[model samples]
Target: MPELTGWAWALLALAAVVVGLSKTAVPGAGTIAVAIFAAVLPARQSTGVLLLLLILADLFAVAMYRRHADWKALVRLAPAVVVGVLLGVVFLWFADDVWVKRTIGVILLGVIAITLLRRRLQAGAGADTGSHRIAAATYGSLGGFTTMVANAAGPVMSMYFLAARFEVKAFLGTAAWFFAIVNVFKVPFSIGLGIITVPGLLIDLVLAPLVIVAAFFGRWLADRMPQQLFEKLVIVFTIVGAVYLLVS
Candidate 1:
């Protein structure tokens, strides 16, 4: 493990908690954790470390919301997502750390823009009624690529679910199962690429409890939050996290 200062440890711990919170409460909030982890550790290494924590949170989320998943949505997204993940792996194999960071930053900003545009359209008319293939190819590709590269798929997937007009529980349930399966899929790729390591696993072990605590806290908060408020918070946090990534 890299020797981290007390402050770094604290930041990472907070980021871990955010991962759990993001999974259970605010879907896009994981972007903040991504930015923090990337800031404190080497970009690729941070991605590796964060992945384990995300999966830990995913487990909690799946346990809570597994039955609510939209299996049709998952099936629609699977093929395109797989392609995107493979592309991301290819990119990771060749890209340096600076490129990785900048790419993530760019992806964050792009997702924010796309999400806002879709929301505006939804408000002006009705929800998007594009073909399922198009939606799957578009969002699923981006979601898979971003998650594979930066563990930053939360915003992309959130936008998709929102556009799909999923009710709160359905949204959480679909996202929970989607990421649980997706993150697990990424593990071998991450390991083969050396993004995941024994040291990263050790760090995750220390932070696991915090993730559990935050997951339940998030569940409580989500249960109480109004739908509109929940949506707004996700957008706001996504914007904040994107800006942090670009400027940091």
Candidate 2:
């Protein structure tokens, strides 16, 4: 382990719980975890640790929502996502710690903006007239880049699924599968970039159980929490986290 203080461990545990919740219930809130991890650890090491935790949570999400995924959507996104991941790898190749931190902050703010836009558009009729092919390519590539760079692709992908007008379970299910596959695909690249390391793996072992428990808790909370309230809270926290990352 990296000899983090008690406070850092607490923050990491909280972020782990949030990751589990975002996986099973709140779709876009994982960005908050991204911010927390980034703020507490080195920018690059934070990405590696969070990626492993997310993959662990992904297993639970897939088990819970696997049957509901829309295979067509996954197929549509694969090619563009691959392109974006490659671009992200190139970016990581050249980016130093400060650049990675600033980029993540910018991406986090952009995610918030996208989520708000998604809500506003969802309130109106005929908000999805864009071609499905174009939409898929655009969102897939963006999602891939963000996920690779900062593990902050939830809101971007959420916007895409919402624009597609997926029902709740379908949205969660498709997202579950989408990330499960993508995150796995990212492992080798992350390793090649030297972000995924033994210290990060040690931290993941400590936090993995929290993710498992919280994922189940999220499933229970999903039905009870008011949607409007959930969205508002997530946006507020994400903004705070994003700003902290930018100026820290």
Candidate 3:
């Protein structure tokens, strides 16, 4: 591992907690860690290093929320997201992170805008009106592309669940499985792209423990909060994370 300054070390620990909590508990918080990686590491190595960390987080998310997945939704978004992953790889090759960051920021803000508009349009939606096939396709493509390029998956996917009015557990569970499967698939590609190095992996070893603790803590917190409050908290963080990405 490179000899990180103490401040960078603290940032890494904070990022680790964000990753675990996002995967296992809050569905939209990983954007902060994505920002952390982009800010702390080199432009190229950040994704590779963060990819490994994300996979670790995915494991914990799967273990905690495995039984509660929405398989049908997974099936619905799988093909599109796979296509997105492919496009993302190509995008990475051609686009500098200036474009990538701007692109994802636009996407995040767009989703948040859409979510707010949707709520205004349908003030009391208990469920979608089966008009969500196109919605699924849109979010899937954006989610896959943003995630692959920037590890910014949370907001894109969160928009989908929010619009569909998923109950809290269902939203979190589906998100857990979705990212777990997709992030694992990204491993070889990340390796091929020369993102993960032995040194970076070593750094991951130190941060991994924080991830585990945060996952458990997130679960504890989630179980204790009222459902409405949890949903509202998610919305607030999503807005914050999205805005931060746009600004940073």
Candidate 4:
């Protein structure tokens, strides 16, 4: 384990809780957890650590929302996601820690931009009806790449679900399954990259309970929270996280 201060551990615990919350309630909000982990650990190491935590959270999400998943959508996106993940692995092979951090920062900003653009287009077009195949391929590839690179694919996937006009529960359910499967798929690759270390695994074990507790809490909050307010807060926090990553 990298020698971290008490404050860094505290922040990581909070981020772990956020990871669970994002998995269950706010779709794209987990990017904040990604940002915090990256800021506190080496960017590459952070991806591995966050990936395990996310997989832990994913179990709860899948259990809570598994019945609501749209299997057809998952099937549609699978091939493209694989392609993007392979591309991300290639990118990771050559990029050093500094490049990884900067790339993550850039990706965060791009996610935010893509999210905003999605909302605007949705408001104008109202529930995408043009091309499901095209939409699935585009978003799937982007989601795979972002998740692989920085664990920042929540917003990208959220946009895709929104475009598909998924109901709230369905969106959550689909997202839960999407990440559960995808995160597990990435494990071998992450291991191959030598980023998933014993120290990181130890840290995940220590923080696992918080993630579990937060997952339950988020499930309770899922239906009750005001969507517009939650989304706005997520966007603000995401921007702050992106800036910090860029400048730090």
Kindly list the per-residue Cα lDDT of model 1 for residues 22-111, writing each as its tens digit.
Answer: 999999999989988888887778899999999999999999998899999999999989998999999888887667667767776786
TM-score for all models, in order of appearance = 0.93, 0.87, 0.94, 0.88
- The prediction achieving the highest lDDT against the true structure is 1
Give a tens-digit lDDT track for model 2, residues 35-122. Answer: 7898899888999999999999999999999999999989989999999888888888888767866776677677667656766765
Candidate 2: misplaced stretches above 4 Å? 104-130, 226-245
**What tens-digit string does per-residue lDDT give for candidate 4 at 1-248?**
56889999999999999999999988777878987897788777888899999999999999999999999999999999999888889988888766866776786677668657766766756544446787788889978987887787787787678666677788889999999999999999999989799988988988899999999999999878776665565566667766766786
Winner by TM-score between candidate 3 and candidate 1: 3
Candidate 3: stretches off by over 4 Å: 125-130
lDDT of 4: 0.84
lDDT of 3 at 246: 69
Candidate 3 whole-model C-alpha lDDT, 0 to 1: 0.82
Which candidate has the highest TM-score of all?
A: 3
Better of 1 and 2 by TM-score: 1
Candidate 3 lDDT by residue in tens digits, 1-248: 68888998899899999988887667788888988877888867778778888888888777877888889888888988998888999998899878888788888888888877877787865446355677778889888898888888887898788777777778888888898888888888888888778888888889889988998888777677777776776777777777776677
Error (Å) of candidate 3 at residue 202 is: 0.8
- The candidates, ranked best first by TM-score, are 3, 1, 4, 2
lDDT of 4 at 151: 81
- List the lowest-lDDT window of 10 residues for candidate 1: 124-133
Candidate RMSDs in Å, in order, are 1.8, 2.6, 1.6, 2.4
